[model samples]
Every structure is written in structure tokens, then in C-alpha cells.
Target: MNYLTVLGLSAATLTTISFLPQMVKTWQTKSAKDVSYIMLITFILGVSLWLLYGILRQDIAIVLANAITLVFNLTILWLKIKYGKTRPRKYL
Candidate 1:
């Protein structure tokens, strides 16, 4: 592997694995109230695009990284929607 490729893979590995902690935490707690729906939605969209780009360009690093990120982010998004509850009006 070339130096540039190694560097890119390293970065991709780190960022992709970094989501593990959050995924495990959310899985265990089954709560994602602190997570932002807009952020997750946009992130999923961006990752999906990146995955497509990687496929078109035949970039393994980008494809692998975005694939993992997409799965993690999707799980979190699903959990957030599943656990989130409707809020009632509160008059103070």
C-alpha cells in the first residue's frame, strides 16, 4: 500500500470505529433523547452519498468507512425514533 493510501485508511478506521462507543451506549440504554434527528438524517444522507461515490471511484477506504458509518448512524437513528416520545404541553 502507498503512504497516502495507508494514511487514508488509518483515518477512515479511526473515525469509523469511533462510532462504536455511541452505538453500544445507545443500544444498551435504548435511549437517544440527546441525539439530534436532523444531524443523524443529514449524516446518513452524506454517508450514503459517500458510499455511492466510493463505489463509482473504486475507493476501498471510502467505501468501507462510509458503509460502517451508515450502519451505525442508521441504528442510532432507528433507536432515536423508537424511543423518542411525544411531549405534552406544560404550563408553568
Candidate 2:
């Protein structure tokens, strides 16, 4: 593999793995009150777009990273929706 490919794959790996801790924490705690619904929604949308972009570009690294990240983002979104109502809202 070329240096650019290696770099892309490495970046993809790190960014994808970064979501794991948050997912595990939300799963264990069963509390996604602090996770913003808007943020999750926006992120999921962005990831989806990135996945499409990657597919168009035929970039394995981008496709794999965004695809996996989308799964994680969706999972967190589900958790947030499931647990969101139980928590009190913050009004500023």
C-alpha cells in the first residue's frame, strides 16, 4: 500500500474507534440525556453524505470509515431517543 493509503486508513481507523467509548458508555449507563439529539442527527446526516461521497470517489478508507461511523451514530441516536424523554429538559 502507498503512504497516502496508509495515512487515510489510519485516520479512518482512529476516527471510527473514537465512537466506541461513547456507545459503550451509553449502553452501560442507559442514559443519553447529555447527548444532544440535534448533534446526533446532524452528525448522522453528515456521515451519510460522506459515505456517498466516498462511494462516488471509490475511496475504501472513506467508505469504510463513514459506514461504520454511521452505524455507531445511528445506535447513539436510538439510545438518545429511547432515553431522551425520561430526562428533564434544560431551558436556558
lDDT of 1 by residue, 1-92 (tens): 89878998999999999888988887677677788999999999999999999999999999999999999999989878877864333458
Which segments of candidate 2 are over 4 A away from where they belong? 87-92
- Return the lDDT, model 1, position 42: 92
Worst lDDT run of 10 residues, candidate 2, spans 83-92
Judging by lDDT against the true structure, name the best candidate.
2
TM-score (C-alpha, index-matched) for candidate 1: 0.87
State TM-scores per candidate: 0.87, 0.90
Clashes of each: 0, 0
Q: How many backbone clashes does candidate 2 have?
A: 0
Residues forming the 10-long window of minimal summed lDDT in candidate 1:
82-91
lDDT of 2 by residue, 33-79 (tens): 78988899899999999999999999999999999999999999898
Q: Which pairs in model 2 have colliding backbones?
A: none
